[model samples]
Target: MAAESDAPERGAGTEKLWNETGIDPVELHLGKDSGYTLRAYRMSDTLPGAKAEEPEPDEAEDDDEDAPEAEADADAVPEDPDADEPDPADFEDEAPEDGDEEEDALDAEPEEVPVFLTRKGKLLVFREPAALVAYVRDNDDHDLAAVDEYADLQERVTEDDIVCDEADIYELDLVVANLRGGQEGWEPELLIKAAEVGRDLGYALKNDSIVSALAPGSPLDDLDEAFRVVAEGGLKGRFAKRRLKRSDPQQAAIAWRGVIAKINDHVEWRG
Candidate 1:
């Protein structure tokens, strides 16, 4: 009888905590350590409200008068016969400018969001856990090995695994600097890897063929041309010897370094 009486008091305390913090107790329990917790609130809950009051007769009368005045003014306006006649152009919608279309395309591309790993090696990708689960389920036969490898990798990765937050852009800068300085032991493979990383991060243009990776008239176009000249004999064979033979290697290096430095300067670190 005493335990039954205490149950209501405990329930009341839980309700009080939930009302104050806006966190559901069930969600807190379900998310534990291995899962993620997402809480969304309605806009009305966050916004302040005006107190309800009796209607003002004078204000209501003023609004009624204004509505008729607006309608009367709109009706009083005279229309020209020429204005009523429509041209063929008026029937057709104006075609969007190429530049406007390009800007829209760029805006439509989704921005990359941050992802985290739970202690139990579960990947917590923002707003896409269900999609990820479905993908894993669909490709179980072909992707089981890859899934296991990723699980192992996530287990080893911690907050300390981050060497530099800007390592993606920094690696490109470092590779370009080495090329500029004519530093020995900087392999062609390093440049290839940098290109791949840059493209993955949306910094570099995607190209179908390796030779056409860098866009024309881009900041890195000169560097791409230089790379092409050096790699004419192919990527693997005598790369260092061919790289040294460029007519203005120093100028190309300086340009590449400036472009990368400008990019690094604009990078922001978000917590």
Candidate 2:
């Protein structure tokens, strides 16, 4: 991959780095020139172990001290007559129907999961998809048409859009690296291969898995959409077709590079 120093400023806190599989957490440091140096550490290294057991209290002394106090406290206060009586308002309002439980269950707020966008040496984190989308729209200089397509794509996304499992991690890494190389070094062949790999990866990883593995508003989501577009002979497909039709290898490379760059922003570090 061609080296580029486009990483955003490092935020404060202990950042957890992951392997290419986006599973195991590792300590990662950026090299002076290119790539990352990773260090693995066990969980025990950071967390404390179980505390030593405390001494047991004397059973005989405990019982003797509690007997008199328990009897005295119990005798001190008599139960109020009104304490047993149900509130008049409670009866007037009537008991809650069975559907109340279902209504309450429906009304309960859904849990929010955090999302992260990780690049070569930067990590952008967000809790909301809209914020991530807004950040991308404001900061990146991408094709407006492509951006709109991505926005429309989001609405159509279902739960089955992304999937990740232990077996697919290695393949995922290979495909992502292929795409990254196409973007960084402007290799047309790699871009084509990346697109092909993307289709398979898309099938392996549904939308939810992709978002959860990377970040909710990640560009990888758009890349998947781009792959679909290319497959369906859309704008990206036209760009690819034009690139392939060009006679000059250098010109073809340049054209393909532009096409790759358009979708490349979404490719990010999963770990």
Candidate 3:
């Protein structure tokens, strides 16, 4: 069969469909908001009456700094009787100009450097991701991965291949240059270096291993001397009696388990 007229002619339900598509029958009839329209205009027929939102009132000034510096300046400026002071009227005009410029500069977004940071000693070093990448690119001695590795540190540590933020580089460089004494000594310096490399990337020290290493009497003895006394005592009494020593047999047992865990988590035991 010949294709019957597949078009909406002049005056069928065509006008109704066109309205839905944002095309008004009258060319310049304003107010047409339709999903299909090329131009966004709200049709008067579809709109509902509603009051406009009122602008909010100015907020109360902050005690710390939200108060304009002009007020502070006025309060702070001393009355110099001997010295010829500038005109007060002139000061008002100058204040707004200076304040406007300062406020403009202050209101402007800060220049954001692409980096993160963590602390080592008294210094906050730029952290990994951006800082590490930049450091590795500049220094021939360190690789990218090593830079990443060192930047991850958080606590007591040491690693050879590391990158650091400027503050850390300064602090660690100075500390290592002039070694000192105390409980930290070498360990602290080492940890400082490690923090620069990657503070977070650390072998989680099993508290048990530390406890075991700290055993009394002999340097070699892994168990605390109190272990024997506690072992002799019943569990509760043993735990209660422990002051400077291990009293909980269960905790001791846990430490033994920690030794095993330490061995498992150790990075160098595969061979």
| Top TM-score hit | 1
lDDT of 1 by residue, 50-125 (tens): 1345579999888887786767887896878777566878889889999999998775555532111211222222
Residue-level lDDT tens digits of model 3 in 1-271: 0112351233434333333433221111011110100111232222222234445444323344476778778789677889976778875643467777887876453431112221121112222324433442344331111223322332212222231212222122222222223222223333233232221212122234534433444331323333333435687435634442333334433433343333224222100
Count of backbone clashes, every candidate in sequence: 0, 10, 19
Candidate 3 stretches with Cα past 4 Å from truth are 1-91, 95-107, 119-121, 124-271
Per-residue lDDT, model 3, residue 179, is 28
The weakest ten consecutive residues by lDDT in model 1 span 25-34
Per-model C-alpha lDDT, please? 0.38, 0.35, 0.30
lDDT of 2 by residue, 1-271 (tens): 2322352322221122122212221111111111121111222212122134455568766776778777688789776977777778876866788899788765453332212223332333232334443444344332211222334333432222222222222212233334444433433333444444333323222233323322334443344444444556867777744543333435433433443343333333331
Estimate candidate 1's alpha-carbon lDDT, on a 0 to 1 scale.
0.38
Please report the candidate that would top lDDT against the real structure. Answer: 1
Candidate 1, position 240, lDDT: 39
RMSD of each: 20.2, 19.9, 32.4
Off by over 4 Å in 1: 1-78, 82-86, 93-170, 181-186, 202-222, 225-247, 268-271
